[model samples]
Target: MGQGQPRRHHQVPQFYLRGFADDSDRVKVVRFGEQPRTFVTSVKNVAVEANFYKVDWLDAVREDLAEKLIGKVEDAAVEPLRLLAQHGELTVQQRGDVATWVVLQYLRGRGKRVDSVGLQKLMLRADLALGGKQRLASRLGLDDSAEVDALWDSIVVRGELADPPTMRYSHLRTMFSSTISKVAAAYVQAHWQVVTFQRRRLFTSDQPVCLWRAPDDDPGVGLLTADAVSIPLNHTTGLVIFPQIPSGITGESAPTTQYHRWFLAHTWMSAEELLILHPDDELPDWLPAYREARLGTLGLPDIQQFIDIGEAWRTHQDRSQPAAEVSF
Candidate 1:
């Protein structure tokens, strides 16, 4: 609310989005729903929500703290991302910087915020089901039976009071401040590869980072459990993090199969629809696959079964449960 403070906060950093822009610095946006449409706009206008990172619970002087912190992360990652995009090379420190940026970006999206609220509601519903109304009321610190009954009805019957913006914002802040470092460390230790597409330009979304796992591998999806995580750095360049190097393939071998699966997963997770970085003169025939993928009817085979990749390296050698499912 202060003079010159940023009121429009971008979920996806503009510098990163510009990597997918055209000669005129505009990007194509495709929206999917009951009515789908396509349009072109500057990267500044997309993937942004007014005061998205504002911490309203904080004092006015520090309301934009999260935005300022996010800006620093984006600034730190600029050079490392450029190096990876241009030369596919980075020093160890640069790799860690980029990994940290990716982890934060993955968690800071609107989709993740929505997931956090949904998960909170789900856990409350589960507790109520298992512990009954009185137990749930006690857990919530409500001693009045009337208040407990009303709260239970709102959650169970009316389906209200499930989404609280302040609580969601607090959870997001906690994730960025507490959970990001551990996840980023795992990404730094994972198999890193730069993928360049000679003929096809890639699509990114409001949710840019894509986490993919083999349908049969594990139900959990996260940086540690996912067989691969990917993000398109530019129209032609992208990064894929795999659990390990495939058994016999050279480092140069692009995981094309994983790319498709990740693309599908990214499409499904997008808050709106796929972002076409560069719109083809004629709409590509494969565009339909985005919708099909979102519908779970894409019919891509279990390609991971043939990839022959090894197990993921864990941060703690003995801990189990696959690093706590950062992705849903």
Candidate 2:
């Protein structure tokens, strides 16, 4: 190791220590490969292997939840609120409030007869499952600590509505691999970079080797090194996280996070996708009808169309199930 020599990154089988709550508590062990290996050591051991990536939860709220809800319809009326999500740089908690508001407004416009109490219950349940708090208060724009505290206590009392499955480094790695593969597919036709997949000469025959090319001068090309691997954005899925939702089957207390070990998914998009979410960007084509329906501006017939669609989605979880369920 000479002074001018470049620091080496660890080869494959990347390991990391991740925390769900605090650095010392609720830590998650992460590894990347065809199969994940349990590391008795901490993530700090190979901290130098990859750059630490932080999640912008706000972007997640907009891109993962709201944007998907809005879909491909273009909506010009809710530009202000949309801008707030895009540029206001709201916190994860704030984003949760916004998502709740959007869903309630949509349901109401469809003559759902929703009220504040119902709204509070929905918000609280979502918050509990998704790992946020003060959602009811935040949605109501109430800064009262007493109200927030009371609500928090009530939420905790509800107990864990949906318990998460037993997670392991292998599960995380398997899911993250799917995340990258999906992203690669989306960007395959894009001009920025060309990534190709091919069979590798190795013992793990199931995993395909990824080869990418960047402009000769691009520094991001360094990501091609063996040491670089995905790390959880915020101790969870980063851009996407999902709760252990109960199966539709009745009386099944033992929750399964990912039905198939190799196929793992979270409730929302991946952290890699969030990097491209920009605030100023125009709403996608799907939002306009969604917004018009939510505001009751659409004709009676059009409103019913959205209502029916919403009902169908709720009934058929397969199409609209949270990203987590699909990813895992």
lDDT winner: 1
Cα lDDT for residue 207, candidate 1: 72
Please give, for residues 138-241, the per-residue lDDT of candidate 2 as tens digits.
66677988887666555543432332222222222322344433333322222221111121100110011212232365433212221212112122221111
Q: Please, what is the TM-score per model?
A: 0.74, 0.18
Top-TM-score candidate index:
1
Give the C-alpha lDDT of model 1: 0.68
Off by over 4 Å in 2: 4-6, 10-37, 47-232, 240-328
User: What residue runs in model 1 are displaced by over 4 Å at the alpha carbon?
Assistant: 124-154, 244-251, 254-274, 280-283, 289-328
lDDT (Cα, tens digit) per residue for candidate 1, span 1-328: 8999999999888898888787777888876656677789888888789988887755899888888888988998999999888755677687778988998987886666666665665555544554556666888899999998898777744447646756547656665775689877777777777777666556777777777777983465776677877787887777777754433111444637566445545644643444556644224464553341132111222322212221122223336555665776
